[model samples]
Target: MCRRFRELAAHPTVLSRAAAAAVALRAGVWSDAAHRFLRRCAAAGNLHACYFLGMVRFYCLGSRASGVALLARAAAGGHAAALYALAVVRFNGSGGGKADKDPHAGVALCARAAWLGHVPALRELGHCLQDGNGARRDAAAGRHLLLHAAARELAAVSSARRRGRAGEDDDGAAASRFMVEWWALTSAEKPATAAGEGGSCGAGEEDAEELRLCSHARCGRRETRRHEFRRCSVCGSANYCSRACQALDWKRAHRGQCGAARWLAAGNAY
Candidate 1:
């Protein structure tokens, strides 16, 4: 299949080159010929080829500067994986050279990638938010994102188990174990608030204040005639005054807890 794909990749078309690059990546074909094909495809503006070639150059060939440049190019084109890769590099200062470790920039890049639906990016962003490494501390939002990521991993595991694919179960089990550990850690950090401490008026005031404010983090805009909030369709635990706020909240926090209510109703361990 690799040989056949390479032959087909000889064509000058963008799709052919991209397909060949993808196949080569999957087959771990890091030969000179494969590199040449990837370079050609990347030069022709194939984002997948650019990302694969960048990774190969960075990890396999140790061409850090060149690889990072290629990754940056791909990221500028809105490649989520490339953006996540750059975030990792920025966070760790692993590529050598100046070793300019910028945690804030890394977190921002991760947030962008998460917004683009990258799972690893979501996990990284959640960790950053939880620890307040670069962004403001928001334990609730971080937990929400982490749980969502775990749920997504669980969904993947369930699919793999159903398919009976070799090695997938091991991966799923590892993800599940990580999720369990994370949940335990988060649970341990919960504050011990005394029940029945506040009077009825205080509870009522809190509930009214919560109802009047938007659920999106830091927005806190009180609902008014111009800004009528709507409850989330899946969890209904939060409300948003506008679609933009809703989308931001979903990307940053609610995505993890979204549909969780349904999963619980169906007796799933979400």
Candidate 2:
């Protein structure tokens, strides 16, 4: 099946717009040829092409209006990523000021994208449901969806590893990258008052060291109960909400700093 797809992909002109966009994407967006292909396909009203080109325009080139128009067009056609991208914009009020934020619309768009099997959308929708940010609070349903999303993420990573493309430019890798970057942005924006000195939630000064956030910077979830999170086997310092978060943290930052001596010196001895 992979060989057949490669054979079909070789004929870019005959490929569907999405396939063509994928080829162009693999060619690297900085390549003039890839850029031209994306532009031409986007001009031809190809939804996937519009999505890629619009993201480049909005994020890389800073062409907000044109990029948003294209993204909106693709989203209107039920492009999952486009819908999710627009949802992020709405949630952040990227179109205007904080007052312009439309969390309800963002939640609605995320729900649509989640229905289409966009993993990030599913995860974001779950968070929204849990917090009642836009939708009515449903902690049980939200937890179920979050667990489902985590399962899908693990499966995606496992599939990528089986294909010998674990770190390649695949959807799973892309989603992980998005999560890392998104968390960085949100962490910077979060108020200092939200977390205690040790990144613990609802902690008094005396119990500050008793509970802590997941050690993964991209997953700053605080432990809801004492000893709820698992500590790293190697260092016994870093905590993680799930195996997926642990893997991501290891890849992103923990690999270099994960040493028993180092953690012990930092007063994380356990």
Candidate 3:
């Protein structure tokens, strides 16, 4: 079976099939063998195999160093998802102490992915620029990029609708999906502030909640005055510093949370 898997992975046309078979094996009883198959494919320079095996090793098996090295190899091969994944790892300082957080390097990786037309990286770079998290603050440029990303997302959705399929393999779908997941991971971190800007609002202070960080994960802007930022139209809990941030946030995180159930709950409480 392992010999057959290696043969299939070696063939360019059947590589995806072999990966799928490996995944199925992992799901059933041959989990260890599946991992070994993936590792072999990755070592053989399969980009997708490298990415999948790297993520599993990093997050599931706790082999952060080797996993990151594999991911870096994939990124160097011009794999857009791999680049974006590495950007996230760097930005969050994963697998290292807080001192390892390299937001600047992360921003550079996002730039490369965005250059390849990755929508999430584009949105992320825009947010970073707006918030000056890893780059110089350029609200105008950031807003423009955000608008561009939103337009691309809408186009992707329209195309998917026309095709009568989810279009999960498209550039837009992967990025949007990743952004939502990334937002979930980083939402709890408070927005940074300059000197003398004071601290984040304490919990349970509903009145002062409006001053909290922008709902957009990459965007760290805080409201300067009462009702300075606008709230989400549906959920009314999320706040955005601008329409661009609002649109991006909707795609990233608010879309899932702004369901009818949430609206009803908030309405009844009010």
Taking all chains together, the TM-score of candidate 3 against the true structure is: 0.60
lDDT of 2 at 25: 50
lDDT of 2: 0.65
- Candidate 1 Cα outliers beyond 4 Å, as residue runs: 1-8, 15-17, 24-28, 97-99, 160-270
lDDT-based ranking, best first? 2, 3, 1
Task: Name the candidate, 1 or 2, with the larger lDDT value.
Answer: 2
TM-scores vs. true structure, each candidate: 0.54, 0.59, 0.60
Clashes of each: 1, 0, 0
* lDDT per residue as tens, model 3, 121-189: 888888889989789999999989988987987897789889897645542233333333433333333
The 10-residue segment of model 1 with minimum total lDDT is: 198-207
Q: Write the per-residue lDDT of candidate 2 for residues 187-263, one digit (tens) a residue.
A: 55346645643321122222434545568774434443356566899888898754445656777888888886466
The clash tally of candidate 2 reads 0
lDDT of each: 0.60, 0.65, 0.64
Candidate 3, lDDT over the whole model: 0.64
Of 1 and 3, the candidate ahead on lDDT is: 3
Deviation from native of the Cα of residue 165 in model 1, angstroms: 5.4
lDDT of 2 at 69: 93
